[model samples]
Target: MAIKMGTGDLAKYPFLNEAGDYLRQSGFDWEELDRPDTREILERAEERLRTAVAGNVYEKLDRYETEILTFVVTLIMVKSIGLDPVLKKYALAEARRAEKFLSEDLRRQSDAQRRALFIKIFEDLFGLKIDVTEDGRLFKVRVTDYLRRSSHFHEQEWKMINRLVQAGQVFLDADETVRLIRNELAILIINKVRGMSLPTLPNSLVERVEQMRAELTPRFEYRTQVVTEYPPCIKHALDVMNRGENLPHSARLMLATYMLAIGKPVDTIVEIFKNAPDFNERITRYQVEHLAGSKGSRTKYSVPSCEKLRAENLCFATAECDGIVNPLQFGKKRANKK
Candidate 1:
């Protein structure tokens, strides 16, 4: 049976097709947004962008129509600004917001509603179906679909070999299922926003758009020269990220710490990760900054030792690495010899 989403559901998930239908039914006019009466809509749209850029979740409004309209307006503003980082940031934030609500609904809603929402979000939107286990404590997805979605996750727990698979299905809990859907939602929003081509914005939105561009534009000084001294493991990590593949979490930590150890700017390291399929600029920036000792603990991180890397299956050591215990020591002896 098809699930019918009400205005409340659409408000919580404005990226849904039903939300678009709601907008069309409401006869929302872009021009009408210029009037003072619609100022709240514009303000909420700006707030959405501001929160997204700040790496925080935007609070949904009390009225469902207003929430839906602000989402559309937010997209228009993001499109108008024409910044890839901002677009990605906004999409990720929106996806996370939806994920939060979905988690709440899955936990609190009646059994029938929860199941319906699960099917509506996963099967209807993402074309991936999940079945509840006989005990009803876990969900099961086909191995094919599981691999397709889980590939985006860098955590070891999400790895197929670590999962419990029976026959053709892989088991997941409600939280895990929702987590996978979050990635799908983010990608869906990113593609949708990228494909939009907006006309000239009304005068009311022009100033706010300029403000967003000024605030969100990255302005860090970074080295342009390519460093050829990267060790094999670092090179492999870079290659994986540059190829838009998911780098394992441990490898990613090793790569970031190694780059920081070699004096790479946080912005530069963050830029390198832009090619990653699951890159979220806000999270990347935060993690890179944390490793750089600019955030948290205030203690800079160091590259993992070669022994640890080997244990993690991240080492690609050659004869050149014979004397080095840490990645930072890779070219030390060679450089000293020269």
Candidate 2:
């Protein structure tokens, strides 16, 4: 049976390795249907991994890069909703705590030493001078400008970067060396970028990496502030995971929304009901009702009006609906729609 995962495990622990070995060594059937790389059109993963490995790509990454990749996808969850601790702080603080869970060599490294190592490794990655602040441990660096100016908005790239960071961190914990992890980082970075069929690496990408490296300038900046953390989508996934439904959370939620929005209440109900043999009508009704709350449960339930949508921060839906004058916004058409 699969083990239950909680927020702490999902966020703190990595979901990697072991599977390939199990599949090869123990005769486990690999699910070909599931894929880590979604951008198949841009880059076929098999071709890239081979080339990246040949380049001696896996050895030279710095701590930060590896840490980022291992834990990158979590940012999506974080961005979708708010994070429990605003990331800038957690990034620095947890770097230490995570080590116990990190290394197979857990006998050594007391908490004090770990904290010191956290500060040292963090600073080394993207250099920043640190100071303890009244609110919490703070590091002064321009994350705002970084976030705005950076091209990291793309989900695919975000996953790649985070994966590298995680790997580098693990290597650092195992070995007491503070060497640049560029090669190890290259393994991930090259593989991910290779996934793309971009004709060339934009000069701008190189420049931005350089600029960020400068800002990190011999130190990583960490701070605790009221920050907008997590994405709406990721938060939704966590919420759904808590429900423990057999269907993937994302699939179920998307289906629920499209079904409700397009005027197929019974079909949605029948579908979800069938899936959720343990379905709770009250819970289902609560979710549907709470959304566009005033509307009753009916075929023509009131789609939120333009003004209502705007006031309620529904611009994304609001814009789509404007054109929707909603044609074929229903039943069978949906399977063929998106």
Candidate 3:
């Protein structure tokens, strides 16, 4: 594959990693697939869509690029009949790409190859797995057989198969799979560009992407005010973790669970821990997902109480910590006061 540098206004996006640039240069852009960017794109798309209640200005974007823009807006933007034309247009385009990508050899390809390709494209574009459902027994069994024979299979892959037991079956045929994957890629690309303000582009062109982004992105109030509500112990743990200090397992769990309980998205929680002394994206994602009830027992963890933190010697009491047992209680008290 040819490796190309990031281009257009996407290179300026604040949260994109070097990997995203590399992938884009290689002709597959998975930009804005991260939690922050995805949220931003959704926000922008929503705002732009609302402003243009009448019609879009319709700048001429590349067919593939436009399809991606349209998908992100339609998918993330609020669910309404207003976006049906844009959604159908890009969805059909993505479907065509999916058909071409799958070709006639889909049946002939080994299940392992199919599984591998499916996983790679999804991960490459969205940094996410296409969840396998209980209905996908044939697909799951084939993938499991392949993993059993492959030494490269690790705990993450193992967990994916486990998740397959519960996820909804979305892949009906090879073409459908391709179409879905392509649609996601389009969203990823749009997320990268539209999530970040388009620098140096003509207002008309930028508006086009933003309009699409607005259509797909949803509206939500910013949670910036939540910082003041953090309990002293959880706040301390976060500060120490951010400084690359080694935290006890209990401390880590408390922080992770506390953040999750506060309605912080999994991605945001994971990003907060990225600065920890031993941060591994795969391991971190698995652990966070596990705590957030996306994996394993599906039981969302609660933050440890003052008593538990004291037991672990992870407690850092301050004036704000007075009489507080659990972090959630602390937050609730503050909210109730307001």
Candidate 4:
């Protein structure tokens, strides 16, 4: 496959030529591009688009050279034309390539500079939440809208912002994006803040997106954070629940008892059981509430001990769990020291 450019190319198809030129200058391998397996290339290309949307754009482009810019443009273009899966697959490959260049350019910046750019981009995408004391407005409506929409913020992207909250760190069983959104909502709680300051993308990257708009047009499933601190028994239960598998009576009791101990609300705990095949909200609520001490003896239940769990065939020990008797104490060994 060969790439054609210049005035004749411009006349044939209009796109951001400058961006294309930059990519063309970098070059690609012709032999690799000349593949006999069109099906494999198409499948891989589609995989690239899915990966790009999920924030793996840079990693996916470690090999491909021709498909990057074209992918982004194609993705935008497909948003208008009804998306054919074939077009979408090719577009995804292109996006990976474009993102590779963007990532490299970003990598060159000083750490602080890069952070400032990310903050700016986030603010531009989602405006600051105004403080009540500062001449107030319909901020609630604005915040509601933001929370309703999806954000580009990912869990891995929160390292810097997480540091700003405190010198020390605390881990919660929620996504970093969820934590960031909650931070934004903190204004409602504190009633003293003006807004959250998140990093934004660099101007060059933003410019590329804007250029696409002027030129053409286009465009979890519960994705909570992995609770690494969870005990093997609890982890097994959660994994089973996620897969729509049933938990035995004892297993359900253990999970409910543990989640309640961790301070998860009754309603939230109820939602967790909603994925079960025999899920009944009324029954789940009664059972959860009963375990939480609202019924019978009014005594909140506790998670089973490792020995008990082992007897029940629910225990699946990890190397970290050795010497721990109680599931509650599994990940807290270090915290217990502090």
Model-by-model lDDT, in order?
Answer: 0.81, 0.31, 0.48, 0.47
lDDT for position 177 in model 3: 37
Q: What are the per-residue Cα lDDT tens digits for candidate 1 across 195-288?
A: 8889667888888888767765553122133446688888888777644445778989998898888887898888887655446688999999
lDDT of 2 by residue, 1-338 (tens): 23343333332332222222322453422132134442231122222222221221112123332232323322222222222222222222233334334342222545544334335433433342222223322212233322332222223322224422321121112322211222222233223333433223234333433443454323322222211222233233234333322233233444355455656554344334332313344556655654434345533334434343333322233222333322223223434566
lDDT of 3 by residue, 1-338 (tens): 32232332122221225434444555733343333534444444444343332222222233333334433443343233223333333333333434464444345556555555445444454454443334432332234333332222222333334434323332334443343344444354434434543224333334445665564334221112234557777777766654434355677788889878878898888777654433455777899999999998998877777887775566777766547777677756555678
For each candidate in turn, the TM-score is 0.80, 0.24, 0.33, 0.34
For candidate 4, write residues 241-319 as lDDT tens digits: 7764447677898889989988999998987875553455677899999999997688888878888877666788988
By lDDT, the better pick of 1 and 3 is: 1
- For model 1, the run of ten residues with the poorest summed lDDT: 218-227
Let me know the TM-score candidate 2 reaches against the reference structure: 0.24
lDDT of 1 at 336: 90
What ordering of candidates by lDDT runs from best to worst? 1, 3, 4, 2
Question: Model 4, residue 285: displacement in angstroms?
Answer: 0.5
Clashes counted in candidate 2 amount to 51
Candidate 2 ranges with C-alpha deviation above 4 Å: 1-131, 134-261, 266-286, 289-338
Model 2 Cα shift for residue 295 (angstroms) = 14
